[model samples]
Target: MKRWCALTKKKTVLLYLDRGGGAVGVCGGLFTATQKGQKAPETAEGAEARFTRWLQSEQLFSIILSSMSDLQEALAHRGSSPPSVISAARSGLSRLLDHLLDQSAGSFSGGASEWLKLGLSGRALDLKALVSALQQHFLLFSQRLHSAEVERRSLRLEVTNLRRGLQQGVPSDHFLSVCEELHQALSREQEAQTLIQDQSKQVRTLSHSTQELSQARKEVARKERSLRILGKHLSGVQKEKQQLEERLQRAEEGQRDLSRRHECVVNCLKSAETSCKQLCHACISRIGWLEQEVSAHRSHVTALRSELQDACLRDNQAFVPVEEFPEPFPPADPETPKPVPLS
Candidate 1:
């Protein structure tokens, strides 16, 4: 079956690795740079160029290109349509490259971070290369299977010839026993081949899982970066406003009393904290909003802390970056007198 186009709407790309009848593996994610709202919309060709440049994220880009070349040769040799396969490669290449950025941007923590050290081991073997190797391995197994079948057929023919020769002169027990041993040996060889194939399949499965783990680690890194940005803005907001800090402290004190009365709220804080991450808008201005809310109405202090926490997590959209300009300095006069050295 054909693996279709990788590019999708919402800045996402889906690249599937087909294993015979089914797609056993995939690697994909959103275009990280799509946050730019003011950029002009480009035509299809221009968009492809943009994706191509973005796909060159670190060293993985070159590795993917090499894999693509190797894959093209495999496809052509297998008698698949060259033009269609080539086009698929072209589209898929961009998708593969774009996903690399998402992988790197994600936060890898816990066991996922540990796996990165051993992930694919070195630069010599990329994901596509690994997939190609697996395909080749399957081909090798098929060849071995055919050889075993031929050998078994030859043994059966030999057994028939031996029985015919022995039938004319009463067959000796030793000759019959020897023929039984040949059949037994063929049976053992078939069993051994079966076992080897099973082990190889297990290895293939493990490799596919590692690829998935690597992609997931990258995704985690992306979210961590966002949370870090949120954290940074929260820190800036808290330090910038003294009034907000005092009000928040009072709210926290009240929350502590409320928590004692309704102990279940402590357990609910995990979900509340998750919601806190979502409220990363207008963080600095949130302080003024909280002050107004506290004045305008009497509400549960627990809810107040959640809002305050959200305010801390999001940065104000109005925060503009100040660009640094290099200051010009006049050059020294060529004939300036040198200072005397201390004796």
Candidate 2:
């Protein structure tokens, strides 16, 4: 039997020829009918693209139908006001196209083919009737879209004229008055800002002065503390001076006592010298008597020797200076010559 292949809008459908000379059921379950033997391999990406295209076509058909219904309703309510309805329909179409594009970019893994197969199962669907309805609605939608473009242009022209009127409509006097008021308000605001800046500067200056005062106060406190320390040192120095004065007074008293002792020793030496001179004179007189009588001198010499010993002991024992002795000794008289002391 001769086998042939046919492609359709939905998918690839496999048709087999039966031995009974009749067409059998389709394989692969695609919308496109083709011979079953030695089928070409369908790539995953190609299948996904086909599915996406089919979905977008169906969505376009639905959008056309919806737009037609809206147009019919709008025409019934407001006889010739088709611009609003047409714009609404255009917006809906745009959204539908966006949705279809999104679905085309989404995941199309292993199970997408199964979903396509299920979608192709008709269950009493009339594709021809759907195509006819889509054609009629699409024509109506196109005509309305053109009319809407014309109306949009007219609306843009009216808006431009209204803008021009607003720009050049007011009196020059009113505009000048508004400008003058704005200038006055701006001048007042600038003055207020200048005053605020001046006040802030004054506050900062005052704060700096306060800091300087605090530093001066601290210096004063430090000086006062130094003065207190100096006072304490001065008191200590005064006490040291008093102690030195007392030591000086005691040293002066000791010097005076040493002077009195020295004077006593000097006077004792002078009195002993006078006594020795007297003894020497007595010895010389005795020597002359002894020469005159040699036998008689022996007894006299013994008595004279005993008297000299007693005189010498008495002079040695004396420790006091003469109270009657003058400070400046009297000179010896020429009539009564003083005796020279023995060596």
Candidate 3:
């Protein structure tokens, strides 16, 4: 009997050979199954049985092939897949399929050395061709998987670099803006401080000026008081001077009046002296005249006495001649004659 099996892109064949021994040893071969063969099975029952077994094997083989393809595809697209683990799985699946096929053919060949000659029909299955095909497929699939993984890793790295660049670029502008704002704030604060200092200076100057003004006012008040006292003293002195002037005028008038009275008294004393001199001269002239009158009267009285004596002598001589003649008669009686002599 001859049978055929199909897997993904591969086809396998089995041949049953009857060896003459009572021990029925089995041998099988595999091919692409596209060509006609002389050993194609003749009995319908045997053909049907072989065809059914080939179908079952093809189904299982297809399942294993599909699972390998899926795993390779996943490895190609997913950067996180482990390459060593995928390689190990692929190797294990290939060896298992080879073992099952060899056992079904009742081959006891040991080691990979017998793998070169497949002993059924005294011909080999083309191991070099099979190894070449498997190697080509494995190399292509592994390359595609590695390339996809590289692309995935490169895309992720590029995204990360772009995000970092954007973040770093944005922060620089923000930092510059913050620095500018801080500079402006510092300038404003300095201006405010300068204004405050100027105001303080002005206040100090005003205070000094006010104190000076107060001192000036006090000096003015003091000056006014001094002037008032001086004025009062001046008025008192003027009154005293006027009183002294009046007293001096009165003393001068009294002195003039006294001088005039003294001159009048001197004139009256001179007039009285002239009158006394005239009265003394008149009294001296009267005494001289009285002395002259007494001398003249004494001379007259002496002359009268002498003249009376001469008259008495002449009268006696004339009476003696008569007396001589009468003497002779009177001598006769002396006593009686004394009386006669008196007669």
Best by lDDT: 2
> Whose TM-score is higher: candidate 1's or candidate 2's?
2
Q: How would you encode candidate 3's per-residue C-alpha lDDT over 111-175 as one tens digit per residue?
A: 12344332323334466845664565455456546755765797798799989988777577787
| Cα lDDT computed for each candidate against the true fold | 0.56, 0.59, 0.57
Clashing pairs in 2: 13-32
> 1-343 in candidate 1: lDDT tens per residue?
0122234442222554442333323332212222345334345566566556766665565667664774557575767677758655754564464344235335222223333433533323466865674675555446545644765687698689889777766457876887789889888988888888988888898898889888888988998998999999988887777668888899999988887857767666866776666555445356567656654544445456557655643433235333442332343223322333322
TM-score of each prediction: 0.22, 0.34, 0.26
Q: By TM-score, how accurate is candidate 1?
A: 0.22
Reference-based TM-score, model 2:
0.34
| lDDT ranking, high to low | 2, 3, 1
Give the alpha carbon lDDT tens digit for every residue of 1-343 in model 2: 0122233324333544332222222333323323355345564567667757975786667765664665556657755566767765665555454344334324322324544444544432357844653464455456456656765797798799889989878788988999999999999999999999999999999999999999999999999899999989988988898888888788777877777777787777777777767776777776555445554554566567666655754664464356743354243222322343434
What does candidate 3 score on TM? 0.26
Worst 10 residues of 3 by lDDT: 334-343
Strongest candidate by TM-score: 2
Candidate 2, after superposition: displacement of residue 14 in Å?
Answer: 27
